[model samples]
Target chain A: MKTYLPPKSTLIVWQIRVTVLLALLVAVLYWFIADYFLVLFCVSLVLAVVFNLIYFPAFLRCYSISVNQNAIIIKSGVFIKHERILPFPRMIYAEKQQTLVAKAFSVSALVLRVARAATLTVELKDNDIAEIMKAVAKWQ
Target chain B: MAVKLKITAHPIMIFYYLKPFWFVLIIPLIKAIVSAVIKAEVNNVLLNELFISVVLITYSVIKWKKLKINISSDFIEIYLGVVRRRYANIPINKISTIETTKSPLDYIFGTQKVKINTEAGKQGSADFWFKLNVGDVKKVTELYPEKVTPKTIKFSAVRVAVMAATSSSAFTGIVLVVPIINQAVRLLGTAVTDLLLDRINKIGQLFSKFMPPVVNTVTVVFLISYFIAFLISFFKSVNFKVVFAGKKTGVFSGLLVLRKVLFNTKSVNSVCIEQTPLMRFFARYLLRVGIGGYGNRKGDRAVVVPSAKRDEVHELFSVLFPKFEPADNKIKPHKNTRWRFYYLPTLFLAVSVILYLVLSYSFPVFKGLISFGFIVTACVLAYYYSLAEYNTKHSCISVAPVIYANYTRWSATREMFCEHNRIGIIHITRWPVDKRKNTCNVRLTVRSEAAESITVKHISYNELTDEIKSLYQI
Candidate 1:
């Protein structure tokens, strides 16, 4: 059995994505209500800093993917912990998906398509994505 | 025997073909009527509607004529489109489910609706849907391979009637009645509907001395609706039968409009035995199986048995899938966490009592009625909560190559049997409260075209991890 932890670059990418989303939200609010633009901007900045510096790292630490000959087990969630297991025989196919932002960070998302319209997705480094795909293909 | 390779859909296809464009087609007719009413152009309006009707009919006829299907040894080819002329060739072995249903409209037209589902397309909608003549439908079904056997089972009318009564609920009855009542009001016009409402009001007023008129009227309507729903269920379950051929299972039933569905037994993902609180009391069960490419909506999964006694259900299940059986060993919830089951209901009872005290004082005239109603509601809720607790205590799970779970969902209890290979995901969740209690919830989802899940609640956290570790060595 091999356990893979997401690279720190993936975490950085996610933090950047969140910061962009917060900036967009504040811009939208400023367009609608100019009176409170400064306050909204300050709140958004604090939220982004707190979330990226504290919450995201804790979340990344908790999330992991373990692959064995039998199944792929995912352990995730911060406060309300969740452990999900997907057996290999139930897997239909696997594919790699990379967005422009993730590509810039050398990170990509691996999607495992299983039966019954269920999908499991996780972000990993390019080498890790290749290794996982090879392992899944061998099982198939 | 020589088989026909090329086939055309029945005339009933016109209805399906026009369904999507009905709104667009009606707008012109409505415009014509409005113009005629305002401008007194009756002659022109008649001519316009006639022309529009002729064009629509001609379009549907031409489209129907152009649409054709060719069934080859290894593939099915469908020729579609009026001007573009597109074709799709689906491999025969890739077909997942073959469903044939006859709605009331199809019955009137002497046709059957066929939906061919494959895993390639959208989740809820079928890949290929067309209406065919009864003879053509038989020919189509023949093209699919099947190994016929002698095993068969039939559901009797008496069992179906009992099942209908036990499974029927007021909510379903109300949903089925609302449309019919709306249509009736439209047909009867304002004056007749007003008279009916006035009579109902008077009846309610006549009972005002005893209780609130609204309550009286609602109770009567609810009872009537429930009875109507029960009758509908009975009719739907009439003449239910199942035939188990070697690799294929065929189900045939329906009252006014006969329905037929054929499934590849190997493609079946899971078997579910469902029982409502009432059915539990009567020791009855409804058996259903989840098959690939089958819709997930209510009444979509193939019903192996509509309703049956406990022993009969077991017998049928053993015959259908001899290798798999319901789990016997039970894992009751820990004694420490058992009180969580009654927490919500006890809170509700307390609130109801407080409300009674406050409302009785404010409304002196209706005090007796309020007290009686609240007390009855409290008693029923208490009874329901006790039953739920009993069910929770009995919930069991087995983690093996094939998982078996019997768990309570809301007020209904469902027993799920599924193979490990067919399981999509096993999720063990620990909420904030559950973390404090040292318990967790386990959810198992079966793999099919649609998602079907079974959840077990309030189990010891250590026990769950141990079970998962034993099964998958996680």
Candidate 2:
């Protein structure tokens, strides 16, 4: 079975943007309630950085999706792994969505909708969308 | 063949609008009563109420005349709405279910309100009523002549009452009332609260003096609430029956308002058999089916049997899914997850002990009593947790042409059976601790628009994954 992963640069950029946003929010709070919030915010920021550093590698390694004859297999985890096997026949629809950041990075997200279940989303290069769509079309 | 059936100038439609007319006249009726009581002048007030009633009647009559219904070979078209002129064209094949409701007025007038539900239609479902002699229902069914000969199962009034008494609806009522009671207590001043508590304690003491051991106000309240819950449940599920026809399953239930629901068996995503703690003692189970568009306001599932014995459930399942035998395959969760069951209760017990010791210093008089109560509560909690653990250990999933899963949620045990291909998605979740323990939770969702899902917790992760892969041929 072949494996697919999201672009590493996109993940890193998204994480940095999120971290910067949180830091800005914390800095604004420090200006108002600076007594213990400063220490709390600093600790939280350090923990977030450490967490991302540890999690990103595991996420890249564990997060893999593949489509076979019968089903679509998605494996993802940081500390705990989850492997979902969604049958193609049961899928209601497949949607391709691209966020502004993802569009800039030339990566798109593919979501497969199944009834009454959590949709499976795979972030990959825009080129892969056609292949995935073809695969889903064949099954349907 | 095209068949045109227009619903217009029907007296039944007048009865349908009667409630709204009555609702509109409530203020006028109250005014008339007040005038009679105050000034002994009822003529003017009565005239005003009569005028309002006449206007409402005229409006209903106008609305009734504007409605048009056409039943064709391929589609059922409904044209109504005076100004906007709303038109709904529902295909015959897409019609999921047809629900009929009959009130006392319907019985008197020999009419029934029919709601035609289609698969996720834009208008939800088309609702209209016509003359009973019209045979509109037969005309609709004739479009799809391919029928399955259904086996009918009717429950006795006694059985229905018992089922109702043990239903979760009663528990829901009790749950609803608790918040209201708490709010009332809060709104009432401390003086009233103290007085009420004292009176309750006195009553408890009186009962205790006659009976052995000490009884408290809490115990009395609990007993009273339980009785109230039983009464509520009994009333909710008074008359219930299941009719299994070829291709369609009809559930006829309700006490004050008779509801008859006919749903296509092909649309049913899954069948669920639930047994609460009280139900276990009675050996009765509640059966419900998950369909895409047919559901109550509270839940997206329809009850086939509100309560039934083991044999009855087996009989029903035999007809519903002939290829799958529920008793043939039973797969249990791993035994290693027993520790997970006892963990929360043990933690709660420890916390209670610490709190009791700390609080004892403030209210020293009831120290011994509080400690005794805490110990008793802990023991009960431990016992219930053990039962829950046992139920979890017995949870299993069987896969064939159909998938049957037996799992426990809180104190209730549920057994669900569905077509393997109908399953929307399969999810396996594991926390960091669960990963280390090699145990995870598996959730199988049915392909329905409704929020119908089943989860089996603390099962061996690898074993379940391998089983699913092999069974589904993934």
- lDDT score, candidate 1, position B232: 78
What is the per-residue lDDT of model 1 for residues B151-172, given as tens digits with 9 covering 90 to 100? 7889889877766766667434
In candidate 2, how many Å is residue A98 off? 35
**Model 1, span A1-140: residue lDDT tens:** 99999999988988988999999999889999999988998999999988999989999899898999999888999899998898877664455666667878877777665643445455788888778776765674
> Can you write out model 2's per-residue Cα lDDT over B93-163, one digit (the tens) per residue?
45567878777776776666777664442223333334442355555555556566657788888877767
Model 2 spans > 4 angstroms off: A1-140, B12-59, B121-149, B169-236, B323-331, B365-376, B379-383, B399-401, B466-474
lDDT of 2 at B416: 88
User: Best by TM-score, which number?
Assistant: 1
Worst 10 residues of 2 chain B by lDDT: B210-219
What is the DockQ for all candidates, taken in turn?
0.04, 0.03
Instruction: Check candidate 2 and list the clashing pairs.
Output: B148-B246, B150-B244, B150-B245
lDDT of 2 at B179: 43
- Backbone N/Cα/C clashes per model: 1, 3
